[model samples]
Target chain A: SQKIEQNSEALNIQEGKTATLTCNYTNYSPAYLQWYRQDPGRGPVFLLLIRENEKEKRKERLKVTFDTTLKQSLFHITASQPADSATYLCALETNNAGNMLTFGGGTRLMVKP
Target chain B: DVKVTQSSRYLVKRTGEKVFLECVQDMDHENMFWYRQDPGLGLRLIYFSYDVKMKEKGDIPEGYSVSREKKERFSLILESASTNQTSMYLCASGILYEQYFGPGTRLTVT
Candidate 1:
């Protein structure tokens, strides 16, 4: 069976530092990959999406890199702030489910002031 | 704003009772989904609807049933609520698979 794995441990970082999160998969190659931000007790909000053909995508202070060769995607948040503290999720889809994403367990991020 | 709304923010029901969790989306999206989030399990899909009066089974559908009568609404039914069914239920809508989620309903079966 296919599996998606994210950093299970919480990531602690300074308010102004960069936070990097990792998502890895085994036995599956999806057509597209996505990232979402989920605050405590709130549904996830869509972030940037990178297709299999794309190497990198950027939005504001966030950047995502998808490397099919490594079977992984890396989500980067630069100039992280206290408000950026939350659990980040990454999903993968075959493109047929209209973006049906197989998500990881998510990595909780806490930005220290 | 494009939004998905669940019928309740929190619910408590007795075991063996029939429970209903409703979801309505304003976006008129072609696809709607039901998911339950647990502490370490991440998000697990329970069911989904592609169109009105149409449905599909997701990874976890054993204890749940769904209803889609109109384009903007989807409901989840727990025929006999059980203690193990206690979890956060989420509703989502989207086109072509990039789903947007509702705030979620935290259900507790006692």
Candidate 2:
């Protein structure tokens, strides 16, 4: 079975600093990877998607990088604010999986002011 | 904006009781999914439907079943709910790749 791992510890950073979160996977080659943000007691909201062929994708102050060779994806939030505090999850889909996505445990990010 | 709505925000059920969690979407998406979220386990897919009257078992489907009679509505049924089934349940609708999720239902079975 494919396994996805993220930083189990919560990340605390000063507001306006860059927050980086890591997601590592094993035993699977995904065609595309996705990022989502989830606040307390709320469902996850879609953030960004990066394909295997694409190395980097950015939206607003958010950026995601996928490295198939390393089997890892990095999610970055630049110029972060206190509002950016949430649990960030990474999901991926392998070949022929269609819309089925395997998700990581997620890393909690707290941007302190 | 796409909207997915679940029947409840919180629910409490007893062991050996049958439970139903309903989800509705307004985006007319063809795919609907049911998932349970745990503290360290992330979101585990229980079942998914591609079209009307179609369903597929997901990673954790042993104690759950799903119904997709209409395109916009999907229901997750817990047959003889157990204490271990206590968790947050989420419903999602997707078109191609990106999925829109509902505000989850927190279910507690005692």
Best by DockQ: 2
Global fold similarity of model 2 (TM-score): 0.98
- Fraction of true interface contacts that also occur in model 2: 0.73
Residue pairs whose backbone atoms clash in candidate 1: A98-B96, A98-B97, A99-B96, A99-B97
lDDT of 2 by residue, B1-110 (tens): 99999999999999999999999999999999999999888899999999999999999999999999999999999989999999999999998899999999999999
Hey, what RMSD does candidate 2 come out at?
Answer: 0.8
Put down candidate 2 lDDT per residue, A34-92, tens digits, no spaces: 99999999999999999999999999999999999999999999999999999999998
Can you give the lDDT of residue A52 in candidate 2?
A: 92
User: Per-residue CA lDDT of candidate 1, range A66-113, in tens?
Assistant: 999999999999999999999999988843654566788999999999
What iRMS does model 2 reach?
0.6
DockQ computed for model 1 against the true two-chain complex using alpha carbons: 0.77
Docking quality band of candidate 2, CAPRI definitions: high
